[model samples]
Target: MKIKFLLMIGLFTGSIIYAQDSLDTRPDRARIIGFSPAKNTKNVNGMLIKYYDEIDHEIKPKKVNGVGLGCNGLGIFFPALLLVSIPSIDNWAINDIGGEPLPDKMNKINGMQLSIINMEPTITNGLEVNVSSNISAPSVTNGVAVSPLYNFHHTTNGMAISTFANVSKKCRGIQISLFNVCKDSRGIQIGFWNENEKRKFPLINWNFKNKKS
Candidate 1:
């Protein structure tokens, strides 16, 4: 009986070991040890030991309910409530091999993003603060984007303030900058120069869709 119990224990131990090995082999479950030339070629959900260029396509956390740090090339698919980075490139969306827009599989960031240089997320749903410039997403932004240099976006639903210039295809909220340009302006624009498809106005411009009486 004792021999049989020992045999069962051995089998269980082996099974556990095998299970762990299997988990480690998964493409998304693998952790990045350091700067790996081979691993950088694929997308992974893990911790990066150091910063690398390919990290934009590699290191990503599955989910972030807490604080996270990204040195550079941090590609995040999931919403990071609070993400702190020092001069990092975030390629949350997948681009074509030729660097063209895919449109359908755009990435979405749902929290506060703090960066030093620039932010080019597919979509930003919260506050995006950049020390230098904020590059608008190809799709849309539903929150606030603040930058000292410039801010650009395809569509903006909230507010965008910049020191130099603010450009957008369509705007539904407020835009404050030295120069503001929008294709379709539905709200208020406060700047030195405001240009819209309707007309170009100095100091301030606004276009409210006429509501049917």
Candidate 2:
């Protein structure tokens, strides 16, 4: 059973990578430094910067291999609003979105992302730090995601730390926050209120296998 489960997991990840690899055609370019609405650039090996007004989600997503910074000029009001919501907004989002959000537009990051708020979907493999109300994945693959608000990911194979809430449609790692939910949990959840495929718990929750299957 364990072997079968592992094989299924491997196949699932393989499929996602294979599908995304199709985006790397001849037009993809690599740059030392890049800016948002990255045009034809497919990879950024140094600094990648973005401004609030320059985003066009229709543009092809770039792969940032180093550092990313954006949403620089929101003054204090935007942050204050997000901070005020706290656990309430995070909880509301969880119930409203059901599981995790669909990633209509996405960028791939392999290092660090620091932003006031995430403007688009992301597949992050390193550190992600933000002041936004929620950070949903394409999935936080193998790193840490830190936010002052909420985090909801399609898959969680990394650590998620948030002040308000953390959730994953499918999980294989840890979540630390005020509220934590995992649709199909295979790891640990540490929070005030926790929910998983197995049960609803408080303070901590965990599920290692799908017994029903």
RMSD of each: 12.5, 14.3
Residue 209 lDDT (model 1): 83
What is the lDDT, from 0 to 100, of the residue 184 in candidate 2? Answer: 69
Candidate 1 lDDT over 1-213, as tens digits, reads: 999999999999667645644445554443333122333212323322223222234323222221112333432311131223312222211121113342443434456545543333345567766554333235466889887666667778999998866777778999999878777678998998787657677799988884346
Give the Cα lDDT of each candidate. 0.54, 0.69
lDDT of 1 at 153: 71
Clashes of each: 0, 0
Give the lDDT of residue 193 in candidate 1: 79
Cα lDDT tens digits for candidate 2, 96-189: 4435455556677889887876656677788888776233234454588888776756766778898877867777889999888877678899
